[model samples]
Target: MTAILSVSDLTVAYGGVTAIDGVSLSVDDGEIVTVLGANGAGKTTLLLAIMGAVPASRGRIALRGTDVSRSRAHHRLAQGLVLVPEGRQVLVSLTVEENLLLGAHLRRDRQAVRNEIAAIYERFPNLGQRRHTAAATLSGGEQQMVAIGRAMVARPQVLMLDEPSLGLSPLFVSKVFDLIEEMNRSGLTIVLVEQNTGKALSVAHSATVLELGKVAIAGPSEALRNDHRLLEAYLGGAADIADEPSSMRANSQ
Candidate 1:
Protein backbone atom coordinates (compact mmCIF):
# COMPACT_ATOMS: atom_id res chain seq x y z
CA MET A 1 0.00 0.00 0.00
CA THR A 2 1.15 3.49 -0.75
CA ALA A 3 1.74 6.07 1.94
CA ILE A 4 -1.06 8.47 2.73
CA LEU A 5 1.65 10.93 3.75
CA SER A 6 5.45 10.76 3.29
CA VAL A 7 8.47 12.99 3.66
CA SER A 8 11.97 12.35 2.31
CA ASP A 9 15.34 13.98 2.97
CA LEU A 10 13.47 16.82 4.65
CA THR A 11 15.56 19.60 6.10
CA VAL A 12 14.45 22.59 8.15
CA ALA A 13 16.64 25.32 9.61
CA TYR A 14 16.11 28.42 11.74
CA GLY A 15 18.74 30.70 10.21
CA GLY A 16 21.70 29.67 12.37
CA VAL A 17 20.50 26.25 13.48
CA THR A 18 18.81 23.33 11.81
CA ALA A 19 15.86 21.93 13.69
CA ILE A 20 15.55 18.78 11.64
CA ASP A 21 18.30 17.42 9.40
CA GLY A 22 17.53 15.25 6.44
CA VAL A 23 14.81 13.42 8.36
CA SER A 24 12.30 11.23 6.54
CA LEU A 25 9.27 9.20 7.54
CA SER A 26 5.86 8.07 6.27
CA VAL A 27 2.42 6.97 7.39
CA ASP A 28 0.47 4.35 5.51
CA ASP A 29 -3.30 4.55 5.23
CA GLY A 30 -4.92 3.92 8.63
CA GLU A 31 -1.62 3.44 10.44
CA ILE A 32 -0.41 5.30 13.50
CA VAL A 33 3.23 6.39 13.08
CA THR A 34 4.63 7.90 16.26
CA VAL A 35 7.54 10.36 16.33
CA LEU A 36 9.32 10.25 19.70
CA GLY A 37 12.17 12.39 20.93
CA ALA A 38 13.32 14.61 23.74
CA ASN A 39 13.02 18.38 23.83
CA GLY A 40 14.82 20.05 20.92
CA ALA A 41 14.93 16.78 19.01
CA GLY A 42 12.91 18.31 16.15
CA LYS A 43 9.84 16.07 16.46
CA THR A 44 7.44 19.02 16.39
CA THR A 45 9.42 20.62 13.60
CA LEU A 46 8.85 17.56 11.44
CA LEU A 47 5.09 17.83 11.90
CA LEU A 48 5.06 21.58 11.27
CA ALA A 49 7.02 21.13 8.07
CA ILE A 50 4.69 18.40 6.84
CA MET A 51 1.63 20.56 7.61
CA GLY A 52 3.27 23.50 5.78
CA ALA A 53 3.25 25.66 8.92
CA VAL A 54 7.02 26.00 8.41
CA PRO A 55 9.27 25.96 5.37
CA ALA A 56 11.36 22.96 4.43
CA SER A 57 14.85 23.98 3.48
CA ARG A 58 15.06 20.91 1.24
CA GLY A 59 13.02 17.76 0.56
CA ARG A 60 9.93 16.21 -0.94
CA ILE A 61 6.57 15.74 0.75
CA ALA A 62 3.98 13.53 -0.91
CA LEU A 63 0.37 12.92 0.02
CA ARG A 64 -1.41 10.02 -1.64
CA GLY A 65 0.90 10.06 -4.70
CA THR A 66 0.72 13.85 -5.19
CA ASP A 67 3.76 15.95 -4.39
CA VAL A 68 2.62 18.61 -1.93
CA SER A 69 6.06 20.02 -1.26
CA ARG A 70 5.03 23.38 -2.68
CA SER A 71 1.56 23.56 -1.21
CA ARG A 72 0.51 26.14 1.35
CA ALA A 73 -0.90 25.22 4.75
CA HIS A 74 -4.49 25.71 3.66
CA HIS A 75 -3.95 23.72 0.50
CA ARG A 76 -2.49 20.86 2.49
CA LEU A 77 -5.52 20.89 4.74
CA ALA A 78 -7.70 20.71 1.67
CA GLN A 79 -5.77 17.58 0.77
CA GLY A 80 -6.94 16.04 4.10
CA LEU A 81 -3.82 16.79 6.19
CA VAL A 82 -4.51 18.65 9.45
CA LEU A 83 -2.30 19.44 12.42
CA VAL A 84 -3.68 19.98 15.91
CA PRO A 85 -0.75 21.85 17.29
CA GLU A 86 0.77 21.41 20.72
CA GLY A 87 -0.62 23.08 23.86
CA ARG A 88 -4.27 22.78 22.85
CA GLN A 89 -4.16 26.09 21.01
CA VAL A 90 -7.88 26.74 21.12
CA LEU A 91 -9.22 30.27 20.89
CA VAL A 92 -9.84 30.61 24.61
CA SER A 93 -12.25 33.52 24.14
CA LEU A 94 -14.57 31.65 21.81
CA THR A 95 -17.42 29.37 22.74
CA VAL A 96 -16.72 25.66 22.22
CA GLU A 97 -19.10 25.47 19.29
CA GLU A 98 -17.67 28.59 17.72
CA ASN A 99 -14.11 27.24 17.91
CA LEU A 100 -15.27 24.11 16.17
CA LEU A 101 -17.01 26.18 13.53
CA LEU A 102 -13.71 27.73 12.53
CA GLY A 103 -12.41 24.33 11.46
CA ALA A 104 -15.17 24.09 8.86
CA HIS A 105 -14.79 27.63 7.57
CA LEU A 106 -13.13 26.35 4.41
CA ARG A 107 -15.99 24.02 3.57
CA ARG A 108 -18.97 25.16 1.49
CA ASP A 109 -21.35 22.37 2.44
CA ARG A 110 -23.47 23.66 5.26
CA GLN A 111 -25.17 20.42 6.27
CA ALA A 112 -22.00 18.39 6.07
CA VAL A 113 -20.19 20.84 8.29
CA ARG A 114 -22.96 20.70 10.82
CA ASN A 115 -22.96 16.92 10.62
CA GLU A 116 -19.22 16.79 11.23
CA ILE A 117 -19.44 19.06 14.27
CA ALA A 118 -22.33 16.96 15.53
CA ALA A 119 -20.22 13.85 15.15
CA ILE A 120 -17.46 15.52 17.10
CA TYR A 121 -19.92 16.36 19.84
CA GLU A 122 -21.05 12.75 19.89
CA ARG A 123 -17.46 11.58 20.21
CA PHE A 124 -16.77 14.05 22.99
CA PRO A 125 -20.01 14.34 24.95
CA ASN A 126 -18.40 16.78 27.39
CA LEU A 127 -18.00 19.24 24.56
CA GLY A 128 -21.60 18.54 23.55
CA GLN A 129 -22.77 19.28 27.08
CA ARG A 130 -20.82 22.53 27.21
CA ARG A 131 -20.94 23.59 23.61
CA HIS A 132 -21.82 27.12 24.60
CA THR A 133 -19.14 27.45 27.26
CA ALA A 134 -16.08 29.61 26.65
CA ALA A 135 -13.00 27.53 25.96
CA ALA A 136 -10.96 29.30 28.67
CA THR A 137 -13.14 27.92 31.43
CA LEU A 138 -12.74 24.31 30.42
CA SER A 139 -10.25 21.97 32.10
CA GLY A 140 -7.00 21.17 30.32
CA GLY A 141 -8.38 17.84 29.21
CA GLU A 142 -11.63 19.42 28.07
CA GLN A 143 -9.73 22.05 26.13
CA GLN A 144 -7.68 19.28 24.55
CA MET A 145 -10.97 17.66 23.54
CA VAL A 146 -12.03 20.91 21.95
CA ALA A 147 -8.76 21.02 20.03
CA ILE A 148 -9.25 17.48 18.74
CA GLY A 149 -12.90 18.27 17.98
CA ARG A 150 -11.86 21.28 15.98
CA ALA A 151 -9.48 19.13 13.93
CA MET A 152 -12.18 16.51 13.40
CA VAL A 153 -14.44 19.15 11.87
CA ALA A 154 -11.86 19.53 9.11
CA ARG A 155 -12.24 15.81 8.24
CA PRO A 156 -8.54 15.06 8.01
CA GLN A 157 -7.33 11.87 6.33
CA VAL A 158 -3.88 12.17 7.88
CA LEU A 159 -4.30 13.87 11.26
CA MET A 160 -1.02 14.82 12.90
CA LEU A 161 -1.33 15.44 16.63
CA ASP A 162 1.46 17.13 18.58
CA GLU A 163 1.34 16.06 22.22
CA PRO A 164 -2.33 15.19 22.59
CA SER A 165 -1.61 13.84 26.09
CA LEU A 166 0.57 16.66 27.30
CA GLY A 167 -0.18 18.42 30.60
CA LEU A 168 -3.31 16.47 31.37
CA SER A 169 -4.21 14.51 34.45
CA PRO A 170 -3.61 10.78 34.52
CA LEU A 171 -7.24 10.17 33.63
CA PHE A 172 -7.11 12.51 30.65
CA VAL A 173 -3.85 11.02 29.43
CA SER A 174 -5.46 7.60 29.40
CA LYS A 175 -8.56 9.00 27.70
CA VAL A 176 -6.50 10.75 25.04
CA PHE A 177 -4.61 7.54 24.23
CA ASP A 178 -7.86 5.64 24.12
CA LEU A 179 -9.25 8.20 21.73
CA ILE A 180 -6.17 7.83 19.55
CA GLU A 181 -6.72 4.10 19.33
CA GLU A 182 -10.45 4.57 18.74
CA MET A 183 -9.88 7.03 15.92
CA ASN A 184 -7.38 4.72 14.22
CA ARG A 185 -9.82 1.83 14.55
CA SER A 186 -12.44 4.04 12.92
CA GLY A 187 -10.13 4.35 9.86
CA LEU A 188 -8.30 7.63 10.42
CA THR A 189 -4.58 7.67 9.62
CA ILE A 190 -2.45 9.52 12.19
CA VAL A 191 1.07 10.81 12.69
CA LEU A 192 1.52 11.15 16.44
CA VAL A 193 4.28 13.36 17.82
CA GLU A 194 4.25 12.53 21.49
CA GLN A 195 6.52 12.56 24.55
CA ASN A 196 4.61 9.94 26.46
CA THR A 197 6.82 7.20 25.12
CA GLY A 198 5.27 4.04 26.58
CA LYS A 199 1.66 4.91 25.79
CA ALA A 200 2.58 6.19 22.35
CA LEU A 201 4.34 2.97 21.45
CA SER A 202 1.50 0.90 22.84
CA VAL A 203 -1.02 2.24 20.34
CA ALA A 204 1.27 3.00 17.42
CA HIS A 205 1.73 0.50 14.61
CA SER A 206 5.33 1.72 14.22
CA ALA A 207 7.68 4.11 16.00
CA THR A 208 10.56 6.40 15.07
CA VAL A 209 13.00 7.75 17.63
CA LEU A 210 14.59 11.07 16.77
CA GLU A 211 17.77 12.25 18.43
CA LEU A 212 19.26 15.62 17.70
CA GLY A 213 17.25 15.94 14.44
CA LYS A 214 18.06 12.50 13.08
CA VAL A 215 16.23 9.17 13.15
CA ALA A 216 18.07 7.15 15.81
CA ILE A 217 15.91 4.06 15.69
CA ALA A 218 12.67 3.13 13.93
CA GLY A 219 10.73 -0.03 13.40
CA PRO A 220 7.52 -1.82 14.35
CA SER A 221 6.35 -0.64 17.79
CA GLU A 222 6.42 -4.12 19.28
CA ALA A 223 9.98 -4.66 18.24
CA LEU A 224 11.01 -1.25 19.50
CA ARG A 225 9.53 -1.92 22.93
CA ASN A 226 12.03 -4.72 23.44
CA ASP A 227 14.91 -2.53 22.34
CA HIS A 228 16.76 -1.75 25.58
CA ARG A 229 19.02 0.85 24.06
CA LEU A 230 15.96 2.63 22.71
CA LEU A 231 14.10 2.32 25.99
CA GLU A 232 17.07 3.57 28.03
CA ALA A 233 18.12 6.30 25.67
CA TYR A 234 14.78 7.62 24.47
CA LEU A 235 11.69 5.74 25.59
CA GLY A 236 12.46 5.70 29.29
CA GLY A 237 9.66 6.68 31.69
CA ALA A 238 10.11 10.42 31.27
CA ALA A 239 7.61 12.61 29.49
CA ASP A 240 10.43 13.34 27.02
CA ILE A 241 13.20 11.14 25.75
CA ALA A 242 15.76 10.50 28.44
CA ASP A 243 19.10 12.26 28.13
CA GLU A 244 21.71 9.62 27.59
CA PRO A 245 25.49 9.50 27.28
CA SER A 246 27.08 10.19 23.89
CA SER A 247 27.40 6.47 23.27
CA MET A 248 23.71 5.90 24.04
CA ARG A 249 22.60 8.60 21.60
CA ALA A 250 24.82 7.19 18.85
CA ASN A 251 23.19 6.36 15.55
CA SER A 252 21.56 2.97 15.24
CA GLN A 253 22.53 2.79 11.60
Candidate 2:
Protein backbone atom coordinates (compact mmCIF):
# COMPACT_ATOMS: atom_id res chain seq x y z
CA MET A 1 0.00 0.00 0.00
CA THR A 2 1.60 3.24 -1.14
CA ALA A 3 0.71 6.48 0.60
CA ILE A 4 -0.72 9.00 -1.80
CA LEU A 5 -0.66 11.80 0.75
CA SER A 6 1.40 11.94 3.91
CA VAL A 7 1.42 14.44 6.79
CA SER A 8 4.16 14.32 9.39
CA ASP A 9 4.35 16.34 12.61
CA LEU A 10 2.08 18.97 11.06
CA THR A 11 1.23 22.01 13.14
CA VAL A 12 -0.68 25.20 12.43
CA ALA A 13 -1.56 28.27 14.47
CA TYR A 14 -3.74 31.35 14.10
CA GLY A 15 -2.65 34.46 15.95
CA GLY A 16 -0.68 32.36 18.41
CA VAL A 17 -3.54 29.92 19.04
CA THR A 18 -2.51 26.43 18.03
CA ALA A 19 -5.06 24.66 15.88
CA ILE A 20 -3.25 21.47 14.87
CA ASP A 21 -0.51 20.14 17.09
CA GLY A 22 2.10 17.80 15.67
CA VAL A 23 -0.46 15.77 13.75
CA SER A 24 0.56 13.02 11.37
CA LEU A 25 -1.47 10.77 9.09
CA SER A 26 -1.47 9.20 5.66
CA VAL A 27 -3.92 8.26 2.90
CA ASP A 28 -2.91 5.23 0.91
CA ASP A 29 -3.75 5.02 -2.75
CA GLY A 30 -7.47 4.28 -3.20
CA GLU A 31 -8.27 4.23 0.52
CA ILE A 32 -11.01 6.13 2.32
CA VAL A 33 -9.61 7.59 5.54
CA THR A 34 -11.98 9.43 7.84
CA VAL A 35 -11.04 11.96 10.50
CA LEU A 36 -13.72 12.11 13.20
CA GLY A 37 -13.95 14.64 15.98
CA ALA A 38 -16.18 17.18 17.70
CA ASN A 39 -16.35 20.85 16.76
CA GLY A 40 -13.10 22.79 17.34
CA ALA A 41 -11.29 19.48 17.51
CA GLY A 42 -9.00 20.71 14.65
CA LYS A 43 -10.53 18.55 11.92
CA THR A 44 -10.94 21.46 9.50
CA THR A 45 -7.49 22.78 10.32
CA LEU A 46 -5.88 19.50 9.46
CA LEU A 47 -7.59 19.39 6.08
CA LEU A 48 -6.72 23.01 5.30
CA ALA A 49 -3.12 22.48 6.25
CA ILE A 50 -2.87 19.33 4.18
CA MET A 51 -4.34 21.14 1.17
CA GLY A 52 -1.95 24.07 1.78
CA ALA A 53 -4.91 26.41 2.32
CA VAL A 54 -3.48 27.19 5.75
CA PRO A 55 0.21 27.60 6.45
CA ALA A 56 1.87 24.94 8.53
CA SER A 57 3.84 26.17 11.47
CA ARG A 58 5.89 23.00 11.61
CA GLY A 59 5.87 19.73 9.63
CA ARG A 60 6.10 18.10 6.26
CA ILE A 61 3.39 17.35 3.70
CA ALA A 62 4.22 14.85 1.03
CA LEU A 63 2.29 13.80 -2.04
CA ARG A 64 3.35 10.45 -3.50
CA GLY A 65 6.67 10.72 -1.65
CA THR A 66 7.38 14.20 -3.00
CA ASP A 67 7.72 16.90 -0.35
CA VAL A 68 5.15 19.68 -0.78
CA SER A 69 4.91 21.26 2.63
CA ARG A 70 5.64 24.71 1.24
CA SER A 71 3.90 24.33 -2.05
CA ARG A 72 1.24 26.90 -3.01
CA ALA A 73 -2.34 25.72 -2.82
CA HIS A 74 -2.72 25.82 -6.59
CA HIS A 75 0.55 23.97 -7.02
CA ARG A 76 -0.66 21.35 -4.58
CA LEU A 77 -3.89 21.09 -6.55
CA ALA A 78 -1.95 20.50 -9.73
CA GLN A 79 -0.12 17.73 -7.90
CA GLY A 80 -3.52 16.08 -7.29
CA LEU A 81 -4.27 17.44 -3.82
CA VAL A 82 -7.79 18.88 -3.91
CA LEU A 83 -10.06 20.08 -1.13
CA VAL A 84 -13.85 20.42 -1.31
CA PRO A 85 -14.22 22.81 1.56
CA GLU A 86 -16.86 22.53 4.31
CA GLY A 87 -19.32 25.07 2.97
CA ARG A 88 -21.11 24.97 -0.38
CA GLN A 89 -18.90 27.60 -2.01
CA VAL A 90 -20.59 27.53 -5.39
CA LEU A 91 -20.76 30.77 -7.38
CA VAL A 92 -24.25 32.23 -6.92
CA SER A 93 -24.23 34.07 -10.26
CA LEU A 94 -22.83 31.25 -12.39
CA THR A 95 -24.93 28.57 -13.98
CA VAL A 96 -24.46 25.09 -12.56
CA GLU A 97 -22.44 23.91 -15.53
CA GLU A 98 -20.34 27.04 -15.54
CA ASN A 99 -19.33 26.60 -11.94
CA LEU A 100 -18.41 23.02 -12.67
CA LEU A 101 -16.41 24.07 -15.71
CA LEU A 102 -14.45 26.47 -13.55
CA GLY A 103 -13.26 23.43 -11.64
CA ALA A 104 -11.41 22.20 -14.74
CA HIS A 105 -9.89 25.53 -15.73
CA LEU A 106 -6.38 24.35 -15.01
CA ARG A 107 -6.57 21.39 -17.33
CA ARG A 108 -5.12 21.83 -20.80
CA ASP A 109 -7.12 18.97 -22.26
CA ARG A 110 -10.33 20.55 -23.53
CA GLN A 111 -11.89 17.33 -24.79
CA ALA A 112 -11.20 15.59 -21.54
CA VAL A 113 -12.90 18.43 -19.68
CA ARG A 114 -16.07 18.00 -21.73
CA ASN A 115 -15.93 14.24 -21.26
CA GLU A 116 -15.49 14.68 -17.53
CA ILE A 117 -18.49 17.00 -17.41
CA ALA A 118 -20.56 14.37 -19.16
CA ALA A 119 -19.32 11.80 -16.69
CA ILE A 120 -20.21 14.09 -13.79
CA TYR A 121 -23.70 14.52 -15.21
CA GLU A 122 -24.00 10.77 -15.44
CA ARG A 123 -22.93 10.36 -11.83
CA PHE A 124 -25.20 13.16 -10.61
CA PRO A 125 -28.35 13.09 -12.68
CA ASN A 126 -29.96 15.94 -10.72
CA LEU A 127 -27.11 18.27 -11.68
CA GLY A 128 -27.50 17.18 -15.27
CA GLN A 129 -31.21 17.96 -15.09
CA ARG A 130 -30.45 21.50 -13.97
CA ARG A 131 -27.14 22.21 -15.70
CA HIS A 132 -28.34 25.51 -17.05
CA THR A 133 -29.88 26.84 -13.83
CA ALA A 134 -28.15 29.26 -11.49
CA ALA A 135 -26.24 27.50 -8.76
CA ALA A 136 -28.01 29.68 -6.18
CA THR A 137 -31.31 28.05 -7.10
CA LEU A 138 -30.19 24.54 -6.12
CA SER A 139 -31.15 23.02 -2.77
CA GLY A 140 -28.55 22.49 -0.06
CA GLY A 141 -28.02 18.84 -0.92
CA GLU A 142 -27.86 19.65 -4.63
CA GLN A 143 -25.37 22.44 -4.00
CA GLN A 144 -23.22 20.03 -2.02
CA MET A 145 -23.25 17.60 -4.91
CA VAL A 146 -22.08 20.40 -7.18
CA ALA A 147 -19.21 21.15 -4.82
CA ILE A 148 -18.15 17.53 -4.79
CA GLY A 149 -18.59 17.37 -8.56
CA ARG A 150 -16.33 20.38 -8.97
CA ALA A 151 -13.58 18.62 -7.04
CA MET A 152 -14.09 15.48 -9.10
CA VAL A 153 -13.65 17.46 -12.28
CA ALA A 154 -10.07 18.06 -11.20
CA ARG A 155 -9.52 14.30 -11.40
CA PRO A 156 -7.68 14.47 -8.14
CA GLN A 157 -5.53 11.62 -6.87
CA VAL A 158 -6.27 12.58 -3.26
CA LEU A 159 -9.61 14.20 -2.42
CA MET A 160 -10.03 15.84 0.98
CA LEU A 161 -13.57 16.70 2.06
CA ASP A 162 -14.43 18.77 5.12
CA GLU A 163 -17.78 18.45 6.83
CA PRO A 164 -19.32 17.04 3.66
CA SER A 165 -22.50 15.83 5.34
CA LEU A 166 -23.28 19.04 7.16
CA GLY A 167 -26.87 20.27 6.87
CA LEU A 168 -28.20 17.39 4.76
CA SER A 169 -31.19 15.15 5.34
CA PRO A 170 -30.48 11.57 6.32
CA LEU A 171 -31.33 10.30 2.86
CA PHE A 172 -29.08 12.82 1.19
CA VAL A 173 -26.35 12.09 3.68
CA SER A 174 -26.54 8.42 2.80
CA LYS A 175 -26.37 9.32 -0.86
CA VAL A 176 -23.32 11.49 -0.25
CA PHE A 177 -21.54 8.77 1.67
CA ASP A 178 -22.41 6.27 -1.03
CA LEU A 179 -21.01 8.62 -3.65
CA ILE A 180 -17.83 8.92 -1.59
CA GLU A 181 -17.51 5.16 -1.47
CA GLU A 182 -18.10 4.99 -5.18
CA MET A 183 -15.39 7.59 -5.77
CA ASN A 184 -12.93 5.62 -3.66
CA ARG A 185 -13.85 2.41 -5.43
CA SER A 186 -13.11 4.17 -8.70
CA GLY A 187 -9.47 4.61 -7.60
CA LEU A 188 -9.43 7.98 -5.78
CA THR A 189 -7.79 8.20 -2.38
CA ILE A 190 -10.01 10.08 0.09
CA VAL A 191 -9.57 11.97 3.34
CA LEU A 192 -13.01 12.57 4.83
CA VAL A 193 -13.48 15.08 7.64
CA GLU A 194 -16.85 14.25 9.12
CA GLN A 195 -18.85 14.61 12.31
CA ASN A 196 -21.25 11.79 11.44
CA THR A 197 -19.33 9.02 13.15
CA GLY A 198 -21.66 6.09 12.48
CA LYS A 199 -21.87 6.43 8.71
CA ALA A 200 -18.25 7.53 8.34
CA LEU A 201 -16.90 4.59 10.29
CA SER A 202 -19.14 2.23 8.36
CA VAL A 203 -17.78 3.44 5.02
CA ALA A 204 -14.15 4.14 5.93
CA HIS A 205 -11.35 1.57 5.57
CA SER A 206 -9.52 3.22 8.47
CA ALA A 207 -10.03 6.20 10.74
CA THR A 208 -8.27 8.63 13.07
CA VAL A 209 -9.98 10.44 15.91
CA LEU A 210 -8.68 13.97 16.52
CA GLU A 211 -8.70 15.27 20.05
CA LEU A 212 -7.42 18.78 20.79
CA GLY A 213 -5.46 18.80 17.53
CA LYS A 214 -3.77 15.45 18.17
CA VAL A 215 -4.52 11.85 17.37
CA ALA A 216 -6.45 10.05 20.11
CA ILE A 217 -6.72 6.71 18.37
CA ALA A 218 -6.13 5.41 14.87
CA GLY A 219 -6.42 1.96 13.31
CA PRO A 220 -8.61 -0.07 11.02
CA SER A 221 -12.23 1.13 11.03
CA GLU A 222 -13.58 -2.15 12.42
CA ALA A 223 -11.13 -2.04 15.31
CA LEU A 224 -12.07 1.51 16.23
CA ARG A 225 -15.75 0.63 15.83
CA ASN A 226 -15.42 -2.19 18.35
CA ASP A 227 -13.29 -0.37 20.92
CA HIS A 228 -15.70 0.47 23.75
CA ARG A 229 -13.45 3.03 25.38
CA LEU A 230 -12.86 4.89 22.13
CA LEU A 231 -16.56 4.66 21.29
CA GLU A 232 -17.74 5.94 24.65
CA ALA A 233 -15.32 8.82 24.53
CA TYR A 234 -16.44 10.06 21.11
CA LEU A 235 -19.95 8.66 20.60
CA GLY A 236 -21.47 7.94 24.01
CA GLY A 237 -24.00 5.08 24.00
CA ALA A 238 -24.85 5.70 20.38
CA ALA A 239 -21.94 3.52 19.31
CA ASP A 240 -23.43 0.55 21.11
CA ILE A 241 -26.77 0.94 19.36
CA ALA A 242 -25.17 1.64 16.01
CA ASP A 243 -23.21 -1.58 16.02
CA GLU A 244 -25.39 -4.10 14.13
CA PRO A 245 -23.09 -7.13 14.20
CA SER A 246 -20.83 -8.67 16.82
CA SER A 247 -17.93 -7.73 14.57
CA MET A 248 -18.89 -4.11 15.04
CA ARG A 249 -19.97 -4.38 18.67
CA ALA A 250 -17.66 -2.58 21.06
CA ASN A 251 -15.37 -4.89 23.00
CA SER A 252 -15.05 -3.94 26.66
CA GLN A 253 -12.76 -6.72 27.75
| Overall lDDT per candidate, in order of appearance | 0.85, 0.85
Checking candidate 1 for backbone clashes, the offending pairs are none
lDDT tens digits, residues 1-253, model 2?
Answer: 9998889999999998998999999889989999977667799899889988889989999999999998999999998989999876899799899999988988999899899899989888999999999999998788999999999888899999887777776667878889998888888899988766777888899999888888888899999877777777864554655523222332311
For model 2, the stretches where C-alpha displacement exceeds 4 angstroms are: 235-253
Cα RMSD of all models vs. native, in order, equals: 5.2, 5.1
Q: Give one digit per residue, the lDDT tens place, for model 1 in 37-152.
A: 77778988899999999999999999998999999999999999999998879999999999999889788998998898888888889899999999999998899888998898
- After superposing all C-alphas onto the true structure, candidate 1 shows an RMSD in angstroms of 5.2
Lowest lDDT sum, 10 consecutive residues, model 2, at 244-253
